[model samples]
Target: MAASKKTLEQRGFHIEVLNLINPLESMSYNLLQLIKDAYKQGDTATAQTLCNTLSYSLYYNPNVKDPFWNNSAMSLCNALILAVIDKCIEEKTEDKICMYTVANMLSELGSKEIVIDKQGNTKNVLDIYFEILPADSVAKMQYATSNFAKGGTTRGGIFSTTMSKLSIFTFEGIAKMTSRNSINLKRIGFGKSIQGKGTPRVRVQIIFPDGSKESIKTDTEGRFELNFKQKVKKGQRIHVMESETKKKMIVEVQTINKDTGETTYKVVEKQDGLQIENIVIFEKPIAVFMIVPDYDSSNHVIASIFIRQLYFVLSKYAGLARGGKCHREVVFLLDEFGNMPPIDDMGNIVTVCLGRNIRFNLIVQALPQLKMKYGDASTTIQDNCGNQIYIQSGNKETAKEISEKLGNQTINSLSRSGKGLSIDKSKTEGIDTKPLLTPTELMRFQEGESAVIRFMKRRDNKFEKIEPFPILNRGKTVMKYRWEYLGDDFDTDQSILDIDIRSLHEYVNPRDLIIDFFPKQEEESFEQPEESNVFVSEPKPVPIPSEEDPEEPQFADIDEDIEIPEEAYASEPVSVYESEPASPFEPLTLENWKHKTAEEFFETHRSIWNIIEKQCMRQWNKSLADIQASTMETFIDELKILVTTGEIDKNIYRLINGKYGEVMDSLLEKEGVKEEV
Candidate 1:
């Protein structure tokens, strides 16, 4: 018996044995009391021996009739144990846990017996199977079984019987199939009650799980429905409240069962009490409308998540449409569209959604912003749009393109041009064509102006032809309706128009809305320390320098006759002063200097003459004296060097004219320079 129990444990049959033995132990309370008494009397050895004896007896002999006990308990246990051992071996061989092994375990534990109402037929034992099987496998199984049950082929029938014996178990499946009739009835009841309405005489009240109630009135046709934006849990009640009139009705609704694919509804009538209705079950693509501001950055990431989810839903609907199962259209109105992450398979959807009755209304700030976010894909998306409307745009490129699309128009042109003396004028008028609205005109359009471009689809042609037109005040009248609804009351101190616009720094606080996903850097405060009240004696003032102090002079006195070297005069006279070669170098009279050019006058100055002479000798192997001797020509040569070297500036001539008027007059006279030509 000990060896057999060990073998059972090794084969995983110990659980079954424990299940059977646990009941026996509870029933044998007197034996347990005797063992406890022995242990309490300080005879632990005897108590342990008694416990061992009880364990041995339970393991060796399970109390039941011969073959019945062996087959139902021992044999079943052995089979289960062997199956587990085989599964473990299979797991080791595969290097992973086989899903079938888990299914087999559930089959053994969760199997149920179903009695077929046929004489001489054996009872069907169905093993509950797991639902982790591939979708194709489940589909194939469902198809084959459904076909076979209708008395098809022998092999198919056998397969069907086998499938019936093992069900792919899901709680939702039972609810979906068994409660279809009830759901249909509820759908009918709700449909009838709401069929005709004008502000429903009856009020429908919905009582949610949290004990909160919402009341709603039916429309003119008596049709009313409530759409819950938030999640609804199971067991929530929805019923119609009492009304004053005899037309009072009660409505009872079941909470929606998402898993079972059930929708909740309620129906009520004056004669009939509140009746809970089961909503019709069918698959339709869910419509989503998202509005996001283009300027909002804080919620961009969150909005991206919504866009991705929307794409996923659309993709699923597309699949359904392909299978000919989709019955309704799915439309997405995405505003500020360019700010979100790229939608997966956007190109494919743009091409395919039209056929599938799925529409995407993408509202973007500008085409460029869209192109920036989606790259070349933006062009493909734009091409797919059947109609495009362009509102007044600050963007020049967009406005220009829009204007050009409006096309050209013919007009008359006239030209006339001549001068007074010639008087040779001819008037010519001819017909010419030009753009109806130029780019500049489009750019200067008012705020409410717009242009429209539409692509008209032809059945015979694969490509669409674009037609463009201009629209003035593109829906500005809608604002009047909005004002009518909101009321125009601007007489308030806190009116938005009265507020002054300032820089972001004035309104934005650094501490507010700080998103700290990671550790933040600490910043030192810039507040200054307070000044001390204690006074200190002032230091003695420094004395200003006086003539008596005798410091070096900052400005030296100029001499009346500063000696300039004779080498400063040129050896050969330059052409500018060649006509007056005998011109005196000093004490120049107005007659001799009057003809001198401004350049000659500049070169005669001491500071400018020295700079020019040095540079000429360095660069051209020519000095002021070598170029011209005792003539205004030498000054002219030096002036050329100064101008060529960019050493003579306008300011130098102005200074010379201001401080050395007489010297300038003498040089001007030598070169025959005059105040005016």
Candidate 2:
């Protein structure tokens, strides 16, 4: 958030940020793996939901009014999923597709990614499409005669793999161009490698049934469709020619001699080749994808998908199921809350996020905007929020709503009347109630004046109602911004702190909060996966247990013991803090604590020992302070664990909390720590 990276460095925060538009290179988020992880955990629902979300992202456009496009998009999305799956299973490879890859792939034949099939085979995704496009007339006629595929009991098993991909090739009976459409007519050869024909944007030639030719260039994902005046007839010829070419041009001349004279001609032709550049982009810990106001609109789809995924991840990791609060908290500060797409079922998320340590701060012009976005659930979302800040705006509706919520304040009114200096004078006093601030007055509030409506405020793990009040900028109306208050004496006329207001929004990818899944992206060099075609040798012999070496007890399926590799286990337990002892040490137990001297006890329980030394050693150098309640709890917990190590003779935690002062006095007196009062 600070302008100076150097200043942020001094404060111990590494800044690695990227905007939303071009996030794929920097994010390296393996969405493919995330989907599989959900499936692996038997949460097939979550995996399906992710697929559905991607489908919506693929077809969503704020401007579009047609629902048909959205439906078609999901169909296309599933096809892409199957395409990727078949490729991975055939090749016996793991998933390497990411969200960015998916984004580009959804538009075309998707990327050539690795997927794992149940039977364990690796594959090239394009080859699955290659199967759809039969090589010669014989293969083509055979496929046409059949209904897409040969029967295998039912319509949706191994044949379903072919079913999803067929959607990509034919939309209204006309097949489009794909990476696998040509491949130099060789499904597998020197030129058919994923790298050789990998570039999505390639020159291609399409030959129609009428013997007419059309050349259409594809987008980065090699996505392009044709306008079919009529549905293509069955058994008709539609040919796609791969025209991949190198940028290098070769110059040649052709000289022809005739009766009149010899004519020399020069021509330039592109070299028939392709260049591959595999530049690896490292992943960043922080990424800020700005949802532009114009609604670049596509970003909303991406943001919505990202936010939903983030909530899913956080809920699983730190929600009530986690048993306790996480070490760190995640906060979403969303501005223009209404402009963005509605986060699905956000009302439920708002109501139950407290214990999870996940918070959402929504900023909007008024309540109506939220209502527009989330419908009736807007009320649930708003009411669940414990705190609300209202600043004066031109909208009288919002002002009136706040005024009514503020209620009425009681006041005493006194009236005295004496008409013409007559001897008699009458005075009347009465109590009455009136709105704290009328709608008109509320709407006319000065800048920096704001009303705070609060409820169920938590402090010390207890809930209390906070009275609504106005934050009047110290004295109601006479307020200025930090920069204006600076009086223009400072350079740039801003505050002393190096703050970059532009970059203040800390839009962290929720995955960054916990996951470190891709360490490969951190490498400074590019490396290819090792390829091999080899077989494993015979298994090593096992040492059977004899009567002298007692056999282990038999376990049920899941409880069965498996041998772990020697290198897998750590030799020693690592300490939490950097300043811990270099040599190995065991925690002191109650049995040893009772017999040991103060010096020996302190050495073993060094957590307690270090604090004593810090106070005694640095008293002259710095101010000595009592340990914080939190730090004390940690030390006492350590002592309790040691007490419970082998046997639990007593409740160490309660004993320590209750008699700590007396114990401290005795221990200090024995250690010769002189008292000062």
Candidate 3:
């Protein structure tokens, strides 16, 4: 029942001309029948109208072959059809009327005003003119060549301008506007050039957008100025006219338009202003000088450390001071000393950082490497900063080499005579340096003690404390140790005469008290416990066998009193004493107390224990015995066990010992024990 109802609904919908098959066939048949009827009646207007209407429908209907065609097609068809009809009318009216109408339209178009819409379609009076202009060949060429000439005409006259006049005005306006925008007003200044000793002269002018001009003459000082003015607007011109040459120069100016988001700039160049005279260029490139010593055989580690330190130092100083944009301070640490590779890492730093206005100083113990490294030691230190100092090296060989290379003052003996700190003022040549001594603070230096100090006053070169600068261990030189091990022995006051204490020139391995002294103290047993007494006295008697009878008769034997010397007689009564004491008293002697009981001994022990406890508390708030025992066992025993068992790396252990060795030594010494190796 549902299917039947749906089918009936479909049939109802089909009732609306669903039987109209083949739309094109139907249309063609209908059109032919209409034409036939019109022809049969001989109604020409009806036939024509019917044919036009049919053609129009064919062009418009989307279902037809030329569907979707709009006004362009309609207008084209109308134009052609109108032309055909006009031709027919001309034929009928003798063609004179057509020619007259065309001529009149052309004349009207030339005088009309015109406006073009956004789509390039002309509006206003010009749109009307376009309706009559002839589309023939002869009229177009003649009119196009000379639009403003007599008898000229156009499709749009209201907004259309004369071709010749338009071309001239557009070109002039564009050129003038471009020139005005390109001038840099802020950088503009007037100056003159001088040839020989004669007074310099140049002409200057300022041209404004309103065609007004101002002129100025440079005086003997060769300077002239155009006072500051309000910013010129876009399209405004600034022309500089030379009074001497009567030449004109266009200045460029630029303006930004926020409304239209456009930048209008005028660009112009003059060949005369391009010829600038009296420009000077310096003859030298900016350079920096650095120094490293030949005796510095430490493989450049020290040099690297020093250079890195100096880099940061100079960077910080440069940051604080101004007007040093072109100035640099170069430090030569490693390969810069002498005849080595020029492009070494050390030299690279100098090349990279130094430029003109830069000041530099280099240090090297010997001239050999410098001659070897730099290819020319004589000229190595020669530059804007020609100053060099020959410091006392480790030996005479080193010192002599440097002195000869620098050609500076040579003091014979730096160590023996201690004339190491000498200055040569005459050797400076073009360079200037005062006898600037190293600051007392910096020169109070020991060997290996060096610092690149910027003398407060000196500008050309830096001052460096030279090596054997005395690693002063009691004012004597220490045998130079391996550079790698130098750091390990640092601060040990190793008898190295002048090694620098302040420098991180070499790796310092921390001193280990355990390795050097712990064992020695242990072997000596430096701390021994003091003897103590914790005992009390007690009365006691010895048993002996009876000599006379089983029951020994104990009697006090009476004896007659004998006269005694007065010297022996006492002031009081002298009583007879028995073997055992009558009173409760004992002799205070080890011999007499040898028979003391266990209880007495225990009381003595308690007394001594209390005294020890109180004394320990008074000092360390801990039992001395306990503290000493615990610290020794934990640090030595546990550490030794861990080390022996391979649980702890020796370096780590050594590091700890190095750091706390002094603390450990002091503690043991306080406990009456000298530190042992």
Candidate 4:
């Protein structure tokens, strides 16, 4: 379980269990636990509840305790689940869970490249779900349900998580057959001969319905049985091939009902084999050790499914026609029973499952808590309980009920009347009815005091009833976890431990999902605000001189303008500043600049116009005058903005800076727009 690892690990038990199957992928394991298993046991109600597990994506009213309140909504969700799963299995695109495996597969952008944003982030399956599904759209799956639902949904998220984490319904060894000695292992072997290629022991592979393959070996006689990691069905194709050479002995079949359908492959005649039966390998069912977290609210939601299904499968097998009752008695010790998710047919399980040899001991703090989760069904559960135990009663309601159930007994009392009135005396015995114990008396029960009420006894079908008895305040001994009380086999609570189960978020390998748009080349450079000039994508940044030094920083103040003829740039253009010498394009002439608009100036002159635009949007109110390059890079920013905003003519500061080697200008100089000293 994702939760409860810490608590279990604290007791020197670190369990890292993840059966998470991506919902977008076809389940390789049994699907019966979710649907068919229940129907087999004639539990249609539970079968439908299991169906609700797949309805995680659907909207549910937080107020609705009953998930089936909106039958149409539930049906729509179930249909989607079945549809997606069917498609995923049908497509079997690497049998991987992804957008493409389901209804909203993202198409590969040319060559195998997946589209990414400027941040290099790509969309996943969850992204598409959120993009199309707006919870508030056809909403009010809210007020329609009871307020017992968690977070405006009837445990939908947990339902999704449970579906994701399923592999074999109830752990590997937990599922049992309907009959004690029932098994149908259909083993199919390749047509490999004892004298075939190499040794007959050489392995052959079987490709599953999903594109994944597994190598299965042939016996000494070139005989082998059919075994599959995934559940096999009638029509699904299974490919047989040689193991080492990666050769398939498969071919297209002519007859498969539809003549126009995609060509289906069959094992080559040499690879085909006969199926042999009656070779059985039975494994004893093992115990399930599940640890759930008490802290998280969703723990109950997750755990409830496991408990419910475990009971369903176990009880179903026990009640089978060929199965003997009480062959394997399964006992459930459920702690904090009231907090667990409300299980379907829990009342029926408690009363009816006794014959199936399954038992459940639900421990809760109070009767009201159980009633809160189970609602009206609590009465059935409580009434059917064979023996109810109370170690100590603090709950007023539970104690009152216990006191009432104890009933009253008639008590005989003798009274003697004697007085100085005529020396006469009389003694009489009378009986009166009084409760064995009052609610107040039971509510004050002390530590170790307890009572057990056995309601009825049933030998086979006949029932024997018992009269109500007093609520006894008998002493009970509790097993302590102290070192003195525990043996060497047990661990004490002196030291605590933990194991973190959450792994790194990075999961998908980009290589599996993408091909590089372009082959490897020189790394591209970006012009960050403080790193390089905005005009160029790659250029030396203007440096600010420290006040302590007072010396000019490189390229901070250019004393002379450097000029070059138009012919010099006719070949490969070079940067005006030598520190970074690669000019992407030639600067426009003065006449061209005068005609260019602000947008044109910024767009043509700057590679990072967007960054400049952002800065300019904020600088409108700030004073751009008298700010020198020595103060900060803003001084250069002001020069660029002045020309771009058309506040001054001819970009006077750029010419004075001598970086662009601009021709001298006088009109702008008259406006006192010269470089700051």
Best model number under lDDT: 2
Sort every candidate by lDDT, greatest first. Answer: 2, 4, 1, 3
Candidate that would win on TM-score? 4
Off by over 4 Å in 1: 1-299, 322-326, 417-425, 431-433, 457-470, 474-481, 485-677
TM-score of each: 0.30, 0.41, 0.17, 0.43
Q: What's model 4's lDDT at 167?
A: 20
Model 3, TM vs. native: 0.17
Best of the two (1, 3) by lDDT = 1
Off by over 4 Å in 3: 1-365, 373-396, 400-448, 451-677
lDDT of 2 at 8: 42
- Weakest lDDT window of 10 consecutive positions for candidate 4: 184-193
lDDT of 2 by residue, 352-457 (tens): 8777767888888877777776767888998998877777667777788878776788999999888887978899999999998888987887776776666654
lDDT of 1: 0.38
Residue 164 Cα positional deviation in candidate 1, in Å, after optimal superposition: 51
Question: What digit string (tens of lDDT, one per residue) describes model 3 on residues 1-677?
Answer: 11122233343311001001111111111112233234334554544454343323223322234322232232322232233223323334222122112222323333443222334343323233223336652222223322332222322321132221112112221112111111111111111111111123765555666766555555455444443222455566566566666655564446644322234444474544322122111111111112233553322222232233334334433443333322322333333433332222333334434532233455555645444443442343333223334334454544443333333323333222223475522322243332223333233435543322221323324565433221223233333445545444333443223321121112211110001111211112122212111111110111112244233212122123532232211122211123434533332232322343312222212232332243222322334354333432232333333333334444333323322333323323444543223
Off by over 4 Å in 4: 1-49, 53-73, 93-285, 324-326, 415-428, 458-488, 494-677
Clashes in predicted model 3 = 70
lDDT of 3 at 240: 57
